[model samples]
Each structure stands twice: as C-alpha cells, then as structure tokens.
Target: MTEKDFVPKKYSEIIEQGTVSWQAPSNIALVKYWGKKEHQIPANPSVSFTLKNCRTITKLDFSKKDGQEDFEFEVFFEGNKKEDFKPKIRTFFERIVQYSPFLKDYQFEIHSENTFPHSSGIASSASGMSALALCVMSLEKKLNPEMSEDFFRKKASFLARLGSGSACRSIEGDLVVWGKHKEIKDSSDLFGVNYADEVHDNFKNFQDTILLVDKGRKEVSSSVGHNLMHGHSFAEARFAQANDNLAKLKPIFAEGDLTKFIEIVESEALTLHSMMMSSRPYFMLMKPNTLEIIIKIWGFRKQTGLPVSFTLDAGANVHVLYPEKDKVKIFEFIKNELVAYCENGHYICDSVGSGAKQLSEEN
Candidate 1:
C-alpha cells in the first residue's frame, strides 16, 4: 500500500501538534480463536460480544519528525513509565507501518491504561491494540480530513488484527465474527465484521460477570499457548468443530434460541480447554476452582431454571453470561457461592456494548 492510497493531498500541510485518544472495549468470544496462522490470522471463524465497561483507554500525541524511521515512541502504563510494554508496542508499530504509512513519520508518546485487569484471562490485548489502532487512524484522519467512515473502521480493524488476532473484534459493535466463513456474509480472515445482524431483542442486553478464579498472571502466555497449537494432536478436529459450531450458531443467535446458544457457547469453552490439555506440551491452565465454579453454575441452573452459562478464555477465570432480566438472581448466586471460588472474591460486571469511541481532547 502507498501513502497516496490513504492520506489525501488537500490536507498535505501536516499539522504540527495534536493529541488523539480512544477507549476500546475488551471482547469475550463465544467461539474462541485459539490457534492462529502467521500475521495473526485466525485459524477458524470466532464470534464475540464487544464488552462495555472493561476496556483500555489510550491517548497518543504525535509530532512530525524529519527523519523517517519505522517507529519512535514512548509508552506509559497507568501513570508509570512501562519499559516492559515498549518492546511489544514497538514490534506492533513495525508490523502496522504498512497499513498506517503515516505512522513512520511521527514521534509518538502513547499513554495507555486498562479498566480491567491485564494478563488475567481478559482480552487486554484486544482493547489495548484496538485503542492504539483507533488513535493511529484518528491521527491519519487528522492529516487527510477526508477519510470516509467505512475506510476508517475497516482499516483500523485490519491494523488491530496485525497486533492481536482478537482485537479486530473490538473495533466493531455488539457482536463481530473474524475469519472467512461461507455461512456468514462479509466475513474475512484479515478483519472482523458485524455478525449480530437480526440479533434477537433478548440478547440485546446480555450480561458478562467475570469471576476471577486467579488474579495472578497465567503460567503460560497466550502467545506460547497458541504456539503449542502448531503441534496439537487435535488441532485439525478442533478447527473443524469450530467451523461447524459457527455454522450452527448463526440461526441460533438470529432466532434468539437461548438454549442452543448456551449449548454451543459452553461446548466451545470446554473445547478450548480441552485443546490446551491435549497439546503437545500438555499443560493445564484451568484451576480446580474453575471446575468447582462450572459444576455449581450447572447445579444452580438446573435448580433455579435461570438461563446462565459460562465461558473461559486462555486462563482460569470464568465469564458468566446471561440475559439482563436474570441479573438479580445471578448476582445473588454469585454472592452466595461463586465468590468463594474467586480470587480475593473479586469480579467485574460488564455486558455487550456498541464497540469503542474516540475521546474529547480536554478534561
């Protein structure tokens, strides 16, 4: 891609100074993307809900530099200078330069902090990378001032995918599906698109209460976990199962069939864990408390008839999902039993939301 393809000529007089910020939501996939190919492309199509409150907010200040380097940036996490985060961010910038050509021409000072806990089974990468992507695209729009809305979001999603596979989903609203699937319209392996079309009213306000079984970081990073999938014994079948599930789920989501939705979502969660267990390295990521929480949730659902279900990411934490109407009873159940299993009795309340948004320049 060329700079002319993105930046317009009329706004060629580059601005000397400006700050852009974006807050992008974390996403919890109902159908997880475990294994990936080169360039962070998903092996199978995965669907996720854009979370509301749990997110990462990033602010970027750019200054035009005479030397055209791949990247020159400073990163701060929370209020402190995060030297460890700089390496990853640098690598991300190098990879994204092709998509955001103007990125190579600026000196960036990026300050980012997450609303939810990082490295604790939450999709912090999704929110974090998507926020940075939004900032970079917003900066480009500042230069061009003529980029269309469709070009803005799509390219941001594409650039975010280069940093993190699941991050593409965080750029879009409600629900998004990534990976090329024949059954879904407008799906692509490079980016994510809205797959929640014709979504039932019942699912409009779905809730996700994250039970932190362990607040500590995972023993294995998701990168290493994904690498292990390269030699997984069941990798082929797992991908097939995911595709089949995606096909089965389209009508279920559109028809508002909660029971079938629960079945597929829970199975996908278990299958993700199962793949981990069956990997060539054969390491366990789920805790005993994870099993306890699942069993109790099952028993509670059987007894109370509340339509709540659970899904897990790459770590031991549990993301409890249910309709908004059952919030009272579900929170009650969480207080009485599930909290005991959680790490430090901590949990986060979030739900499906309308993707991410840009921030005003001032306080």
Candidate 2:
C-alpha cells in the first residue's frame, strides 16, 4: 500500500481521556537494510527475525488539550524524566501528524521502559518507537471504531518507520520484510509485511544470544552511514546483492537449509561492516573482542558441525543466531568459551517472537 492509504478518515467518536499501552519487540535482520532514501525508504529489501525477550513497553496517556497550538507531550524513560528524548519524539509527531491529525487534539504523556540496559549496544529505537506507534494507533482506534486490524497494524508500522526505519519490522512476528521487492507480495517501502510463505519447522523458535562486546555508543550513527551511501562507490552493487540474497533466502527458508542460511546470514553481517569501512570517512564498529567472539564461534561450529552463526548491528555487540535444537550446545559454548569476550561477561538470550501486543490496564 502507498503512504496515502494510511491517511485516516474523520473520526466518528472522540476519546478525550484514556490510556493505551503496548509492548513491541526488537528484531535482528537476516538480510540487512543499510541505506535509505528520503522519507526513510530502504535502499534494498531486508527481512528480520523478531525477538521475544528484548523489548520496550510503552504506555501513552492522553487527555483533551488545553489551548495548545502545537503537539504537546511529555516523556519518561524507565521511571525517570528524560528531557533529551523529547526532541526525537517531537519530530516523530510532526512527521505523523498528517496521517493521524487527531494527535493535535490531545495532550499525551508517554511512559516508556526497555527490558535491556539503556546503553547495552542494542538499538532501543526499534522497539521503543514501535511500542509508541502502536500506542498512538490504539488511540486512533478509539476514535475510529470501525478500523480493521490489518489497517491498524500497517499504519502503526508506517508511522514507526518515520521514527526509526527498522522499527517497521518490529510490529510483526517470526519473520518480517520491509522495503518493496518484486518477489515479496504486498511488500511496500512504507511499512513491513509478514513473511507469509511456508517456513520450515527448523527455523521455529530460533535463538539469538547477544554478547555485549562494548556498551558504548558507536562513533557514527546509522543516519550518517545511510547518507554516506548517497555517493558510495559500491552502493549500487551492495543494494543489488541484498536483493539477490533475499531471493536466495526464499528457498532456504522454505527448505530449512541450515548451511545456506548460515552462509547468507554471516556474509550479510560482514558485508554490512565492509561497507562502513569502505566509506569515504572510514570507521569500524566492531571491537577486537568482537572478532575474538566470531573466531571462537567459527571454531565451535566447525568442531561440533553445528550451524552457529553471528550477525552484527551498527555497534560492537554480537548477535549469535542458531536453531533451537542446537540451543543446549550453543548456549553452553557461548557461556564457556565466548562470554570471555563480552564486557563484564554481559549477554542476553532471546528467541523468535510472535510480535507486539497491547497491554490491559492491569498489566
């Protein structure tokens, strides 16, 4: 669907005062999305495994506005008032107000918290923005009582993308694809779509153990990296490669080919870092310990003939991905051999998840 499809109709009812709460999960890209265009459109299609344990819970409280000319809201993170987060949220409101015009009619209080540490090298923007978007959509639902479930989710994802590109993929389940691709039915650059094709049982409940190699923030933000692609020498080839890898994944996912899955996932991870290193202003996100953990994973995988692989984000942390059946051995290997590379031996274990959920008042 196009962005115009998300513009809502006049509300038949009004919700002057109410609260909406939602929990949204973060996701790990199997095929990464590195570059983007204006309006946060992805340069190439990417798919991710939505995570269960690492998530953000957001509660949005709204009441009738008292003569405000602009968007009015307050933000609290982990029970502490965070004034620094307001600017980003304000920008989000400005971007989405055209689609959800009723936002100007209410004063909102956003209470948000994450399951992981604030600076654990994990990007909370995906889960945090998605949770906030779902809460906003929930408020919209109260205004337009006839809204369909499909539209609600699509619009929430659409809005979430404006806040953070990867957030669009956090609104849904085990596998979600963002960005338009000919092979992916109903794929849109505007939002994420669930992978509706037959997925083999081997991938169910796939595990991701994130080892915190460095909790410090990256030197370059994702926005800077994306902008660098504008004049990047190998940008076109990289975008094409992502699409080709995505196509190749179709059969691998359906047939449950662990070997091919490992090949693609690992290559994609390295390719992402390669791009960053090759950019005009070259930089590296992976620390020395990151390479150490990777080498150890390779040794353990080869020794046991298990399908253990790793993926990295725009930071130093490593996300170890493996099938559920290998969890016992893999977890043991991680704790025994790989945890030494982690900062203070900090790590988190998560598995494939079903998506975001709305929470009741009691929750």
Candidate 3:
C-alpha cells in the first residue's frame, strides 16, 4: 500500500501545525473473537466491556508537509523512541489514508504510553491503535467540520479494525459488539457498535481486576494464533459455538442473569485457550499459574455465592470479573489467594469505562 492508492474526493490544505491527543481503553471480550478473515474482519462476533483504567494515551504533533507525500511519522512510548511500532502504524495509515486523508497532508510526531504494562498481554494494540485512530479521526473532523460525531467514530472504529481486529471494540463505550451477527442491529464485520443500551444496568459497570500471571510477552503473537485456526478441525465448530453463546448472552445480559453470564464467560475463556491447545501446530500461552488462578476463582465462587467469574485474553493474565457490589469480597479473596499466583504480586484494578476522550486543541 502507498500514497498512490489513497485519492480522497476532496483534500483540504493544512492551515497550520497542531497536536491531537486521544486516550482509549483496552477491552476484555465476554464472547471472544479468536479468528479473522482478510483485512481484519472478525470470523465470529464478540462482545466486550471498555475498561476504565487500562488505556493508551497518544499525542500526535502534526506539521504541514513540504509536498505531496505519504505519512512520515516517528513514535515514542514513555518518552523514548519506539521505532518498532512505526511499521505497523505506517501500514495502518496506508490502509486508512482514504478515510483520513489529513494523515498524508502532515508529518506526525506521535508519543504514546499505556496506564497498564504492555507486556501484561492484555491487547495494548486495542488501546494504542484505537487512540491513534481517534487522533486521526479528530484531525479529519477538524478539516471536515461538517462531518457528524457518528461518522467520526465510525470511521475511527473502521480504521482501528484495519490495525487490530479487537481495536474496533475499543472505539465504543461499556458493552460493545463486533462482527456481523444476525440478531445484533448495526453489527458489522468492519467495526464495532456500542451495546450498552441493549443490556441491563448490571453489566454496565462490572469490575475487571486483571491478575498478571506473566508480565512478559507471549511466545506466540495473536496473529500467529489466529492463523493456526485456518486448518484446525475444530475451527468451524468453535465459530458456531461462539455464535450460540452470543445468542444466549443477549437475553442474559438484558435480564441480569449473573449465573448464566458467569457460565458463558468462563466457558468462552477456556474455549479460547482450548482452540490454541487443539490447533494444528499446538502451542500454549497460559502459564502454570494461570490454571492455578482459574481453579481458585472457581473454588471461591462455589464457597461463596458471589457472582464472580474469570476470563483470559490471548495471554497468561486472568481478568477476574465481578459486579461492583462484590468489590470488597472479591478483592479480599484476591489479596488472600490470588496475588501469590501473580508474577511480581501485581494486578490492575479496572472497571467498565465511558470510552475515549480527546484533549484540548493545541496550535
């Protein structure tokens, strides 16, 4: 992909250099999306809660370009250069330049950092990519002042999906659905739509405390894991099961049925890992402590009639989910039993968030 491929119908000239900053949160999938089609299309629909604290804040300092050119950007994380992140950003820009032509009209100096550790395996790409996408969308909206907020967010979600399939989910608040589910109105394989209004208030503010079993990068990247599902015997069955779970979840979410919700959420987590274990060239991303934490969560739920459950991302970290009412009870359990399973006795306390925010304009 190159600048030649991007030809917007109306291109605006840059008036002056400015900066745009946006912060977007990572999300935990309730019904996981494990596979993908081309151009970052999800193979199965998934639902997620936009997290409150685990997020990425990206500031893009823009300058008018010398002449017609593709995007030329440098990225930094925590005040240090992150050249490794540039290639993906470049590719993402190339893929979405048609939607956000302002990107090619300026050179960008991007600085990004996360509230939670990136190595914690919680899909920082979802947050980071979404933040960058939001920044681009903000610039485009500035240039095209007539565009509606819905169009801006929709384009941002669409652009973010081009970078990471899960990133689309980060563009919306609270409960969100991604992929083309028959029953879900406005659902699309291209981006995600907010599902907060469709569900009961019980799910709107659920807590997700992440237990970092391994604060290290996974041996297999999520892309490689998704690729493995292509020839797996269980791929078709797994996709169908996800659809079934999603179908069941809609009523449960609306009615606030915690028991059934726990059952589905836990099963989806295990099902995700199960796919990895059953893949053609099998590999494991879960650490020994990951299982220990899961067992403990199950035992605690049984001993106490708490509405607590656990879910895992594509890594070793365990997201211990529970209602806001169960905060004290669940944290006590975490401190007493689960912290020992953590790598450095660490975790992140987060909850359902309100979604991305844009900073004040800077000229």
Candidate 4:
C-alpha cells in the first residue's frame, strides 16, 4: 500500500520523524472467560491479572511505498514465518483504520516478538494482541495528539477483541473485567473495566501458581468447546452452575477469604471440564498425569489443611491458587510430586499485578 493511501495527514507528519514502539504483558484469568456470546464476547464477565514476566514488544514503521491502496502487513512468531496470522493482522489494521480512516492507505511494516514460548499455551495471544493494539494506538497518538487515554484503551481493546477473544482482558493492568455488559451491534454493549472497581475492597491479596505440567497445545479451542457446550445435555445446568459460582464467589473474593476463594474456583473449573466430558462424543483434556496431579493436590490439602486450588484452561497445565502465606508449603509439595511429570516443567509464582505497559523504547 502506498503511504498516500494509508497514511493520513496526522500519521504522515509522524512518519516523517521515525518509528514508534510499544509493549504489553500477558494475563491469566482468575475467573476464566470460557464461552462467547457475540463476536466471542464472554458469556459471564471474568476477571484476570496481567502477568509481569511474560510479555510482547511490537514495533511499527511507516514509509512511502509504490502501488498499494490499503495497508500490507506481515507477522512473525519467534522469527518464523506465520502466514496464518494474516487474518488477525488484517482485522487489527482494519479496526485501527475504522477509528482513524485517513491512515487506511499506507503499507504497515510490523514486527513483534514474544518473551516466552510461542506454543507453550500460556496466553500468548493475550500478550501478542494487546501489544499490537498498544503499538497501533501509540502510533495514532504520535500522529494525532488529540486522542484521550480512555478513548485509546477502550478503542484499542475493541480492536484487540477482533483479533482474539482473550485479548480484551489484557488491555488493562492489575485486574480487568471483560463482558460485564450485554452485547449490541452498534459496539456499545462490549467493554472492559478494572476489576478493582467492580469487586469489593478486601480482595487484593490473591495469588496463583501456574503449574506448567505440560506445554502441549489444546485439543479443543474455546470456540469449539463453547459450541459443544451449547448442544450438550447438561448445558443449561452448567450455565446455571457458572452463574451460581459467580454469585457465591463475589462476596468471598471481596472478603479476601482464601478458603472460600479456593472452594469456588476449584468447583467452577471442574464444572467447566465436566461439561466438556458431558458433550456428545465425550472429549477430555486431562491426561493420566493430570489426574495424578489433581489427586496429589487434594491429598496435600487434606494433609496440610491449607487452602490451595487448581484450575485448568483448555490445555493440560494446572494453575494453582493459594495465599501468599502458604507459598513455602505449596512449593515444597509441587517440587516433590509434580515436577517429575513435566519435561523440564517450570512453575511461575505470581500475585495479581497490572496489565501491559511500555517497558522501554530502546528494545
């Protein structure tokens, strides 16, 4: 795409200066967003913390080019060609242009790098899409300094959601909530808000241990899993259970009661999986080792009387949640029992933290 077509007068003024960069970190859901309603918006509103260590850095450069009306772009994952990423790239650029249509013509030179394994299943899409959205917004701001931060984050999140369902949660820091509102076609229904604003004051000390049991990709994506849930015999019951769990956990989480939090999260996760099993054709993500780990955690809870809970995404890895005070005992138990099952399995202990941010421009 030619710069004349893609670069608006505002962006063109900035392009004459140089390139701009931005970075954002990945986030893990505490109350997971499993199903989507409209445009992959969550069925129930969910909350998550943007992780500190795992992140992605995105760089955008603009230059005059010959023969192109719309922007042309390329995406790479860890230096390997990622042809399939075109749709996500195209969607993201389209959203950006929708907000600032004048820049629809310029060709985009985009490069992104992840700090963690691409296929390790640790919410890579969350970080990648969030970073891309942030970089695009940063470029927009450089070109036109009139945009507000609220408008930037909300619009960026709107675009990010088009890329991946989980990406909207990564737009905010510390704690974020996606799908609190109903879905509407005019784009007024979907939005993300900070969890602290929605939840009670006493819920800040929550902690989670990501048990990297296995990094293998998931057999069923969230979209497929949700579709399966729709026709399953227990679909209604499962939805009711999710609603009940959400109701019960709000007060418990607000009170910062580790015991109640563990009970609710564990139950919800198991219920989510149970619905998966009840689906026609009977699919299950848990391995034999997965069951063993669950048993071990149950036994550890029985033995120590500590409040520790485990939850799984569509993948096999277990995310262990416990209070910070119990970290020592939890670490010892995991090292003794779970470490051997993994191929160089590693664990990351993190408490809730802020979402993605620009780390440095030098990178």
- Per-residue CA lDDT of candidate 4, range 1-363, in tens? 111232344443434324556677777666666656655666666656666667788776655455647777666666666788888688666655755553454456667787766666576777788778777767677667776788677766766776676787777777676755322112222545665434444445456667666777777776688777556787666656655665566567566676777777777777777877888767888777777788888998998898777877666777776666777887788778877765477766666667767644421
Taking the tens digit of each residue's C-alpha lDDT, what string does model 1 give over 129-210? 9999999888878777778898888888988988888999999889999998898988888788998457887788799999
lDDT score for candidate 4 against the true structure: 0.67
What tens digits encode model 2's per-residue C-alpha lDDT throughout 1-363?
777888886889966798889999999999999999999999999999999999999999999876758998899999998999999999999999999888889998899999999888899999999999999899888888799999999999999999999999999998999999899889989999999988999999999999999998788999899898888989999999999999999999999999999999999999999999999998889999999999998998899899999999888999999999988988999999999999998999999999999995321
Model 3, 187-237: lDDT tens per residue? 888778987446776786899989988887788999999999898889999
Off by over 4 Å in 4: 1-17, 64-68, 91-97, 100-103, 181-189, 197-205, 360-363
Q: Enumerate residue pairs that collide in model 1.
A: none
- For model 3, give the 10-residue run with minimal summed lDDT: 1-10
- What TM-scores do the predictions have? 0.95, 0.98, 0.95, 0.84
> Model 3 segments beyond 4 Å from truth?
1-8, 11-13
Pick by lDDT: 1 or 2, better one: 2
Determine which window of 10 residues in candidate 1 has minimal summed lDDT: 1-10
**Per-candidate local distance difference test:** 0.87, 0.93, 0.87, 0.67
Order of models, best TM-score first: 2, 3, 1, 4
Runs in model 2 with CA error above 4 Å? 361-363
Instruction: Specify the poorest-scoring 10-residue window by lDDT in model 4.
Output: 180-189
Q: Pairing residues by index, what is the TM-score of model 3?
A: 0.95
| C-alpha lDDT (0 to 100) for residue 258 of candidate 4 | 69
Where does candidate 2 have its weakest 10-residue lDDT segment?
354-363
